[model samples]
Target: MMKHKLPPIYFLHIPKTAGSSLGQLILCSYPQGSQLNCSLSQLLQMSREEISQFKCFAGHWGTGLFSLLDKEISSITMLRDPFERTVSNCLFIKRIVVKKFASNPLALDEVEDLKLKSDISELLKCTNIREMLNLMPSMKEQQSCYLGCDIDLNEYLGVSQCSLDTLDKSKEIFIENIIAQQLSSGLLDINEIFNKAKQRLDAMEVVGIMEQFNDSAHLICNSLGISTPKNLPRENVSPENLALGNLTYRKSGTIPDDVIKQIDELTVCDREIYEYGKKLFNKQLQTEKRKFFWFKKMFKKSERF
Candidate 1:
């Protein structure tokens, strides 16, 4: 008899999509340090030999990494409502600035000039939405570029590890090109990215939904035949922190209606992909109804009651 082999797992992590927690959860089933977390800088160090040894890959990787590995891989990912994801990101950054400044406002001086422009404090310091809009190509544009790919970073610029080390363009010019390329392809065209993400998604085994994370986690564990993690719904959220507003900003503080309309226009590509993602997630979930049902029953029991 032949045995089934599960290919290495890759996570297509979109920003603020609850990927951090999911990565932590997926990290559990594999040996420690086997999961390679890729960042923009670290991506420069990525190699076929280094990645092929890992049981899992996570971080801002997308279709681009597919070509680097020696074998085909199974992938899982999650998507959030584009606008909500945007709001959460701004709030998250706002919190970071507060923490960073509270600890050491002087540390701001050391950040790279390009990144410092959108530093959370600078983003909020803008007098109005229009002024803030100017600062965009702000973190929001970076976020959009990440989603623009169904991927991100060097991949977004169509550059690679080898090219990045020697690239001549300033970060500002490179970003301008990223946005220009999107608009030039269409009147804000995304068919190229859209088609790619769609095709890639079709091959994915699990596409989780951030809004329905608890159920999605159940489905992922159920299908993979792995022991489900204990803190089912959210593994690392701090309810007390959120309640105090000590560590986060509110949606109302970050984006108003006009900002949303502007943001909606920018994320039209993501909105299209996310809607399709919803359909795919629901379809995948249906396949594990029996297992998920049993998991749900266990959660429904209340020991205190």
Candidate 2:
């Protein structure tokens, strides 16, 4: 009998989705040395020979990485309700800034850029989600940006490793928007970006829903020809951080209706992609069920014979 080989997987991990947990399952399905989890900059530094050795590539990278790949791979990602994701992200950032700055008021000063320092400081004062989103304009349509934006492989290859190293430093951490820069600069209109993202999404082997995580995990396992685990790991859940206690950001029913309206406005593009993802997920689920049903029937017939 020939052993089955799984295709390489590229997990385009959009932030605030349950990608961390899904990533663990993916890594477990492969052998120890066959998994590589790193930032886009780190991946860019690898020679093709070095990169091809890994069976799994997972990270907070955008679709742009696709153009740089040396081999064809199965790509997968999860989509969340845009409003929920956007709000969760705002709360998470708020929690982090408070915790990090409370320990050292000077850390805000350490952020370097005058504008960024001002922004972080402004974020510190934000009494509500609307205020935070207003300060972080790049965060709007963020999900679409990840799925839509495609980089020129040649351009990134020419960039200095040192400059890329700076990206790894805190300069890009939690604040800088590599994907949003293109959108902010008007390199591509939001509609164009959303359409591209949806097109790429439609082509993915698995498009999981965060709300339907267990089923999503099962579908991913099916794609990899692996047995589904009895329990899917839940990692990096939005913490009920005490730091944001005064903000009440994570509590259910706490967000104001007007604020929700603002989130809806900001996530207009992301909202459409999310709805599209849901339809795709449902279609894939039905197909998987049929395959499973046939597999069971065949096994029963073979047992009688």
Candidate 3:
């Protein structure tokens, strides 16, 4: 990548989107101390000078720092099958607070994050759709959460123009209210939101699909000149013990047909985005393969010359 002087890579790691697995790739490919993994809060604390030092910046960040992107920085992210991603998210939410309860001796309200953690725990445990209205957009429209700036509600709704910066700050609560409001009114323009997300994905340097991870890795490697990882490591997998030791999170389980229907209804936008993204991924994989082979041939010819 340095040989080509390509822009540094910015991974918008939407939570549970194989971020840990991708972290291993970034760590191995980049020089020591050049890779930075900071939370949204930590990122805000860093000076612009401090942020410029890293070749890679990734974590559960919203679109707040989108202005920081430029021609010198290449950006990428992965999207999973939406319904499945939602299942993984809810299960992960249920698991985390349960673990917090086991270890933290203080009351749930002692820490602010812990209180939110407990709220998430309750959200996942609730079997009814009405109780889940407060589900965070981070779980429902997660790809939008990371690529926050890409979706413009105003463009489609003809509403007041709100910047990604505004969404980054309020999208969680905003989406929750939207869901609750729609549920109450029995109408929503979810397709409008999805169209905006599709536009963003279409504009990405390259898109990755979680189910087709190996192909995605090869494409990423080819695009950035990073070594292709034959085996993408799985981190934060659900342990057999579940809710003990480390936070056990899993993407596996049989959701009831009724619950699955509810998820489908809530994540209509994600379902469309994932389907369209999968089509794009197939096209990108073949293109990356051609580039990979051509680059290899050129290198060999140069060596001989």
Give the top-scoring candidate (lDDT): 2
- Residues 119-215, candidate 2, lDDT per residue (tens digit)? 2324434554344455454358877878887755435553444554455444332222555566578898878888999998988999999878999
Clashing pairs in 1: none
Q: Model 3: what TM-score?
A: 0.68
lDDT at residue 208 of model 1 (Cα atoms)? 86
**When superposed on Cα atoms, how far off is each prediction in RMSD?**
7.9, 5.6, 8.2
List the candidate numbers ranked by lDDT, top first: 2, 1, 3
Report the Cα lDDT for candidate 3.
Answer: 0.59
Worst 10 residues of 2 by lDDT: 112-121
**What is the Cα-based lDDT of residue 139 in candidate 1?**
34
Each candidate's number of clashing pairs is 0, 0, 0
Per-residue lDDT of model 1, residues 214-294, tens digit only: 777776665555767678544445332245353333243543556667667766767777888889998877767855687
Clashing pairs in 2: none
Off by over 4 Å in 2: 1-3, 106-138, 157-168, 173-176, 241-251, 303-305
**TM-score of decoy 2:** 0.81
Question: All candidates' lDDT scores?
Answer: 0.60, 0.73, 0.59
Ten-residue stretch with the least lDDT total in model 1: 168-177
lDDT by residue (1-305, candidate 3, tens digit) is: 34354447777676667777876676567777888776443454455566677887666554434544443666677888776677666656555545545465673443344334323334555433223324555455655434533322222231323443443433233323433344346453445455656776787777889777777777777677666766777777544324333322232333455666767777766777788888889888877778779999999999997
